[model samples]
Target: MASSFAYDILSNKIETRSAKAGVIGLGYVGLPLAIAIARSGFAVTGFDIDPKKIVSLDAQHSYIDAVANDDLATEMDGGRFSATTDFAGLAACDVIVICVPTPLTKHRDPDLSFVEATSRSIAEHLRAGQLVVLESTTYPGTTDDVVKVILEKTGLKSGTDFFVGFSPEREDPGNQHYHTATIPKVVAGDGPQALALMKGFYGAVVKTVVPVSSNATAEAVKLTENIFRSVNIALVNELKTVYAAMGVDVWEVIEAAKTKPFGYMPFYPGPGLGGHCIPIDPFYLTWKSREYELPTRFIELAGEINSAMPRYVVGKLAEALDMRSGKALSRSRVLVLGLAYKKNVADIRESPSLRLMEIIEERGGKADYHDPHVGEIPSTREYQHLKGRKSVDLTQELLDACDAVLVATDHDNLDYALIANSARLIVDTRNVFARLRLSADHIVKA
Candidate 1:
């Protein structure tokens, strides 16, 4: 098939204003993309296996708090946006985008099952005039190596019979300022024509579109950005531990060092790295590097240091307990504040809070968590032993019952004064206590 056929077919559809667009996996990344494209005057069809999510979206009940409720309602009411669980609806679209989850296995291997399954579905309906863009974060070559192989099943040559590209989702949940329309999108395709068409399409919806050399280069950009974060975070975490031993306040030192305008961008020490991107994305890059006999030592080392932080925090809690009444972690009633990993909202996909809570329990200390956002966490089978400890409402009685309170995350809603006065000992891992005017003896700034 000639490349012009692909371009001509897609151009004809676009000119007719009947160029239907489909998005698979309408979660964080996909929902926003679909809304933006629809708002820009495209008929968008969102597909997800979750019937409940599709139903909610159709009813204009926004599940994610980060997305504006009014915008979702507006899109749905205008007949520009719709969602479905049916795969047959995808065949009717001229362009399809995949934004599914690419999680890791228990052993940290690339779990590409979701991506593979989604690709196969897209391939089933693949036609000569289709533009496919992958927005999931994964290994560098995944767009070219994994997605392309499955897409080729249609016997359609990519960049010729159809267009294909890789454009990583830089969606930062909870950020108020930057959004899908404003954030500069990076995209690359199999060929120059494909790149130009993708650039033109995305440039219509977003503020800026950065075109790279190839699909692989575009995929590598996201991993490199995340790996920089993982390594810098590990460096600061290690320094935090070393400085604590030397009786130095890591928070104060960081405050001082941040004064250097040119040299430093401060990354604070936390109980551990949390969120979907920082903790898990680096491992995917390292896993891919193993195929070429290249070792991602820095990323692997960073993972080691960051993962051990929960154990280190447990040790700090034990030491704080000993200082108060000379009691070991055994029988220590500990209340952990903020189970949602970060502050202000609920999202615990790869939360370090899970491991932190487990370490506390393993050390013979009873642990309970309090988070206004999270009600109940679905426990994996391995954690069935610690089931049924409900997230207590942040009440005075609940706060006073624990022997100590650990501030793993600092949200604005938490009453620090109440926590300071009620709990016997407080271990502040996220520097929550550092910003307070309260007395130092009540809180241990770990």
Candidate 2:
């Protein structure tokens, strides 16, 4: 069949919402997206290497907090969506979207291992009619320079024999305001046919489809949005420390500053950067920029400042415990409130609370955490030794047993009033006790 005929056929399928969609790496970004595509009337097949996730999805169970059980079950019951660990299924897909993770390397460089592996697998199954889109957050030129080269090995030219595009994932876990279907999608493709087919596919699923000039533009857009957040968060985190030394309340200051209708946007300080995007995406650019012999000063500085937050939060706990009960952090029994980076989400990727625990344990502190979302702290590339650490329950008895409580994550499910009146020593990093009348020596905003 001619490539033009294949493109026209894929376009017709997308227009009719009958395109067979295949999603790779069904994690936070991929799972919700697969559901959205299935709901759009496409027979979506999700591809993940993990057998556990494949089984769960096949059984109508959702492991991601953003995807509800009912939503997953609806698609499975209708036979619109299914999951598999097989890469051979890619041969049947008209639209294949890659949503793999682009994490940082051990030395803080951009790690493209997952993306490279996915591209290799897709290359083996490179069919002429397939429109392959990368939704992973990565450096520019990755689709053209990296992925394009791999797929061409199958003797088919991108934009000639097959279609390719770049679309970044914008998934915010626990955010009820926007989701996969509502969040506007940005797409850029290798050529005209690739762009049109990509737009038609996402246009069916999302509320709006934003078309950009090139694949690099779509890739850069994701990095730019995340870098802005990283820099702003670094600014406020630095200010939090400077203002704290001046005996000024930074949280209160931010509450007043955000009242201005123009010229200012508020980004609060936390224990540190958590989640997949904020802490990791900017470095993708940083690694790429180095090849051009240019430096990213703001990104490097932000990482330094944000990375120091765990130690800074731990120091505050030490100070609070000593001043309140003349106890050292080494001997003190400290309880961390939440482990997830964001509230109401079970995702603990690069969570600062885990870093807080790591630092405390290094300093001889008896560290334990209590989070409604996470019962046991799972290991990551950074903290492998923290595995199997179960969450401790928060209670009057538990509070009395602990020498100090560190409010690392202020999950809304927790009763702050009960914790405020009962705890003897509290280091509220999130300002959870800001409205409460805490004693001069009992509570300190870290």
The prediction achieving the highest TM-score against the true structure is 2
**Which candidate wins on lDDT?**
2
Question: What is the overall TM-score of model 1 with all chains considered together?
Answer: 0.95
Residue range 1-446, candidate 2, lDDT tens digits: 33487788888989988779999999999999999999989999999998999888877889998889999999988989999999999999999999998999888888889999999999988888889999999999999888888899899988777899999999999998999999999999998889998888998899999999899999999999999999999999999999999999899999999999999999999889999999999989998999999999989999999999999999988887877789999998898999999888899998999899999989999998999999887768888898999998889999999898899988989988778888888888887777554444578888
* Model 2 weakest lDDT span, ten residues long: 432-441
Q: Where does model 2 exceed 4 Å of error?
A: 1-3, 435-441
Alpha carbon lDDT at 349, candidate 1: 65
For residues 1-446, write the lDDT of model 1, one tens digit per residue: 23497787776666555688898988888999999988888899999999999889877888776667799999888898899999988888888999998887889988899999999999998888888889899988888888888899778888778888889999877777888999999999878867876786787678999999988898889989998988988999999999989999888899999999897999988889877788888999889888899988989999999988888998889998998868788888888888877887677666777777899888888888988777787664345565555788777888767888988878778888888888889999988766877756868976
Report the backbone clash tally of model 2.
Answer: 0
lDDT of each: 0.84, 0.90
Pull out the clashing pairs in model 2.
Answer: none
lDDT of 1: 0.84
